[model samples]
Target chain A: MASTKTEGARRKAGRRKKEDKASTADLLLDATSELMVERNSAEVTFADIAEHSGLNPALIRYHFGSKAGLFMALLERDAGGTFHNLETLVAADMPADQKLRHHVFGVIKTYWRYPYMNRLVAALSLESDSEAARFIAERFTRTLSEAQRRILEQGEREGLFRKIDPTLFYFSVIGSCDHLFTARHSLKFAFGVEEIDDDLRIRYSDHVASILLDSVMV
Target chain B: MASTKTEGARRKAGRRKKEDKASTADLLLDATSELMVERNSAEVTFADIAEHSGLNPALIRYHFGSKAGLFMALLERDAGGTFHNLETLVAADMPADQKLRHHVFGVIKTYWRYPYMNRLVAALSLESDSEAARFIAERFTRTLSEAQRRILEQGEREGLFRKIDPTLFYFSVIGSCDHLFTARHSLKFAFGVEEIDDDLRIRYSDHVASILLDSVMV
Candidate 1:
């Protein structure tokens, strides 16, 4: 009985250790996100992140392996579920138009919730090494584009959506979805929109989905 | 005859002096543009600009007043004509749909020619003082949005366009127009598109115009 209790204790200890590691990583990521959003930039450094997280900078290097790895991990943490949900939506039994509209809303809301995401993706893809860039493209861009392609194809098959190049559609739709969030200064200065509250986000989402649906619908 | 010759020589000297000043300023602007394009950033220092232009750094301060002034000047040089032409286009006798399609093409082409233009505008607006940001919005963002509002209103009145918010349209259209250029690395990594040639630009232009026109048309 003592031997069995010892084994159980060891397993419990192992699980507790793993949970501690995961929580520490999450704390680092949360700090990174906060710093990036507060600064409105993806150029936040390890020192900044360390100070913000109140953790040793060495912990970051240990957890993420490198800055590129940390960024990639952050992308995965923030957007992994989003991309996964997109695939599920694509596979679901909904009509093409409905799926596309939902996809549009999801993209906008994702940006709304994490204003630094698309910018982070762009920065990583632009400045990181080729391997990191490729990983990002494969994990994020390609997945989104592929899901879009499937939806476009499905819509065409359903005789609902007009034939459009999925590649071009990817750029346009993604661009339109994220613009309001990205161009916050333009909103403030040009339109006197000082804040992007939930109401504004919904309104903008409806506007984008409306126009895009109109463009693609028969 | 001697008095006439003296006056002529003095005038000639004055003209030469003015032309020399103008050319030196132009040289500085040209060097700034070249370095920005080469580095894909607007963070180029005054020292870098001076070294590239082979002009004393003091000349930049003297000619433009400050870095913000220099950026503002660059915007005027690059986009001033585009905005002026947009005003002309709005007042033209063309049909609303045709005008909007042309505007879409114009926007895409502008970003293509000056890939750094929008990014520079965003950076200036985000990082600079309120005065500079306000100036940029007044000079560029408001002008673009107002032209779009006029076009949209014209389209609605002419029974050619569905009602849409001009502000939302501004974000969507500009976002769509500039995405391909800004997401260059995404294109390279995701689509294996290493270069954005005229062919791609023309094709993308047609695609954006078609969808946007379709969305807005009654």
Candidate 2:
């Protein structure tokens, strides 16, 4: 009976340790995400992250094994959330037009919520030779292609979308929306606007959706 | 006769020195443009640029006065070229449709020729709070807005384009094309492509033109 009680206590202790590690990892990533928004990723250091997270610098090394490892972890965390959201949207039972609109708007909304994501991605995209960068490139492509394939298939079945290359269509839609925000400085200056408010975002989103629907559909 | 020859010699010496300085400045800017393509501006340093340009490190300081000054010179040089091309296209007495198509193709070809320009602009877009960044941002925006205003005026006069917000339309069209290359890695992954080739670029240019024409035309 005493042995049984000790085993139960040990199991609870193990669960607590797991929870602690998870929380610490979350804290580290949260700090990294915040910092990345303010500055370029190349400008960030492990010590900066530790100071921001209020965790020991050594803990980062212990948990992630290195600075690059920590960056990859942050990317994985954000990408996983983004992918999950994408999967849920794609899995819904809706008309292809509605699905496409939702998917595009949803992505724009997600990206806006995390403005640093595009910069982080832009940085990695250029550094394609790195392992972490390659992972991001590959994973994002696979995820997007799968979602695009499904959307295109649905549109084709409904005879709504034209029979052009789905990949090209997808790229156009994404490029239109993503560039507006990533190039915010240039866009704002060119248009004499200060910020991308809610109304403008809605209009921009509608414009992108129209471009995609009008070009792809009959 | 002696006074005339002495004056002529002095004039020649001054011209030689001025030409030397101009050539050295050109060399630094040229090297900077190349370095900026492979790495972000923040990663570039005087030493790297000197090594690439085969000029003394002090030459950059001597010619441009500072790193930021050198960057500005590069920006002015490239922006001047791009703006010149755009102006030439706009000044032509072509119809709205043809003018728009030529302008779109011109921008795409320019981007492809100086791929690093996009990277530099993207970086500037993010770091626009800085003086140097803002200079580039302002020039780019002013150039784009002027082109857009000309296009809109032409479209209105020709009764070809629908009455739409010129700024929003400009942003959408430019965003669509620019983002594709800027986010080339993500697009490549999503489409399972190797690299953006000539055929893909041509298709993209054509498709963007079609979408813009369809959306804006009566």
Candidate 3:
């Protein structure tokens, strides 16, 4: 009976250990996301994360093995879904213009909702020499290329857009949207605006859509 | 003539002092520009500037008076002719489309030449309470608004563009170009490209111009 009880105890202990790990991982990710917005990736430390997440510094080492690992995990969690969602959204059966609109809106929504993710990505791209940057770059490029291909193909079929290289078109559209928000402070300070309101966003979005459609469409 | 010799010596010393100040100021600006690319504005220090610029640390303090002053001087020097040139290029008696094309190309050239300026502006914008950030924001807004007004007046006069709000159009064009380069690292990483080449840039400029013209033109 003692042996059986001991076995049951061991199993229960194992289950609790797994639960503890899962919770710690979740806490670390949440903390990283919060800190990233206020600070650059290079400046972040395990100590700050421990203090914020309420996890021991050793726990980071024990679980993720290092700060870089923790960072990678955070990125994996955030970007994995975003990239997948974008591909699905792009590939869905819809009109080319509608697909383009949805794709742009989806990206804006993702950036708005998880601003920390954008900051982290931006910081990593700027500072990191690791595979993370390469991974992200590859993902962005492939996605953009695919999106351009689809837009061009659709535009050709509908006889709407000019026969311009889709790559240039893609870059222009995406570039405009990213810069507006990234350079928000400059724009606001220069223009004297308080915030980029919904009305303004819509107006901006429609303007882009019109410009792009008008240029490409026959 | 002991008095005459003394006077000559004093004047020579004064000329040397002015030369020293000018050279020191230029060094600080150059150092700041280089460091701004590798490090965020917050991470930069007086020591780093001094070491990088090969000037005395005290000289930076003496000339610029503070880090902010040095940064402002750097921006002023870098962006000196960019805005003025753009205004001149766009304000000429050309068709609205040609003006838009010239403006787009001019911006691309400026950004390509002074890539660090984009980052510096971006970093400033993220600073919530920074006076520098406020200044940049206000200036950019005013610039964009002015551009919008010019485009609208020109387009309307030429009977080329629709009666849409010029501010919205201005935002769209700016957004497309700025985002393309600012988020370039991510885009390049995602796509597996090195640099956006000249051909691509021209295509992008044309595409942006086409879109804007198409949206506005009758």
Candidate 4:
């Protein structure tokens, strides 16, 4: 009983050390995300992030190879859950319509949380000849396209949705999901909506899902 | 008769001189537009514009007052037709469905030609406390929202379309229209589409129009 207790205590101590090391990186990432959301832009500098997190600036380069590397990590951290949830939803044993509604809501919710994500993705992807860009393209962009293709195919097999080109549909659906967040100025200036609260987010999600679902329904 | 001929010749000379002065500004704007499309970005500089147009950099400032002024002028030159066309279409006696399709096609075509307009508009409007930003918010953004409102109202009045929030519809429809051009990198990486050719543009227009029309149909 003494030996067993000793081993359990040692494992707990090791886990604590591991988590402590990981938390620094997590803290930096959280700082960057908060700055991005607060500024509604991806133009935050290393100094800003360092000051925000109260960490040494050198630690950023040590943890992430560069600014782009840091942004890439932020993207992964912010989007990891979204991609996983999407895969599970695509494979879930539910009707296509229900799955689609959930997927639409999921996308809007992701954007709502990380309104700077789409801009970050676009900038990273547009960096010519960067390995980070290629990784994002294949990992994030391709994954999204493939998931969409599968959902459309499954929906067709179930006779719930008519045929539509997945490529065009990608532009249409993702575009619809992204615009409200991207054009916040327009929202405020044109409609007097100064903020995207939970209520507006829910209504926007329903609006997009209903329109797009009707667009593809048989 | 001799005096009349002289007067006519003098008037012709004046007209030629006026055209010569105006064409320089037009040439600079055209060069800027060409550079934007070629680069698929709105980051063109005045030196680049001068180099492309073979005109002095001072001419740009002289004509446009500043870089922002130049971009504002470009937006006006490119989008003036679209706004007028929209107003005319909204006031036309055609059924709402037809009008919607035509509007969709018109918007897609405009983005196709000036793919940088959306980015330009976003930047200008995001410039806080700037008179130009306010002008864009009122002249361009508000104009679009008003036109959409009129269309939806007409559609409901004709009993040909179901009721939907114009504000949400603005996000959905405009977002759908702008995404294809804005996410060109996604097109290449995700779907192997390198360019937005006329064939692709037409087909995309039809897809958006048909799906959107179905969504709003009574």
Question: Candidate 4 residues B1-218, lDDT tens each?
Answer: 99999999999999998898799989999999999887767778999999999999999998988888888889999987688889999999999999999999999999998988887777676555477666677888788878888888899999999999999998898899999998887888777888999999999999999888989998
Clashing pairs in 4: none
Candidate no. 2 TM-score:
0.89
At residue B93, what lDDT does model 4 achieve? 92
Per-residue C-alpha lDDT of model 3 across residues B177-199, encoded as one tens digit per residue: 65556667755666555686787
The window of 10 residues in a row where model 2 chain B has the poorest summed lDDT is: B120-129
Q: Model 4, which residues run further than 4 Å from truth?
A: A1-21, A54-57, B1-21
Instruction: Judging by DockQ against the true structure, name the best candidate.
Output: 1
Better of 1 and 4 by DockQ: 1
The 0-to-1 C-alpha lDDT of every candidate, in the order given, reads 0.87, 0.73, 0.68, 0.87
Write model 4 residue lDDT over A1-218, tens digit each, in one string: 99999999999999997897699899999999999887766768899999999999998998888887888888888886689889999999998889889988998999999998877887676566477767677877788878888999999999999999999998998889989998887887777889999999999999999998998999
TM-score per model (chain B): 0.95, 0.83, 0.82, 0.91
User: What tens-digit string does per-residue lDDT give for candidate 1 at B109-202?
Assistant: 8888887787678667766577778877899999888989999999999999988889989999998988888777778889999889999999
Give per-residue lDDT, candidate 2, residue B210: 79
Best-first order by lDDT = 1, 4, 2, 3
Model 2, residue A14: displacement in angstroms? Answer: 2.0
Against the hidden true structure, what lDDT does model 1 obtain? 0.87
Candidate 1 chain B lDDT trough over 10 residues, lowest sum: B36-45
lDDT tens digits, residue span A24-58, model 2: 98898888888876653335788898899999988
Between the candidate structures 2 and 3, which one is better when assessed by lDDT?
Answer: 2
The regions of model 3 sitting more than 4 angstroms off are: A1-16, A38-43, A61-68, A116-118, A191-201, B1-9, B37-44, B126-129, B164-171, B186-192, B196-200
Report the Cα lDDT for residue A78, model 1: 85
Assess each model's interface with DockQ, reporting 2 decimals per model.
Answer: 0.70, 0.54, 0.60, 0.63
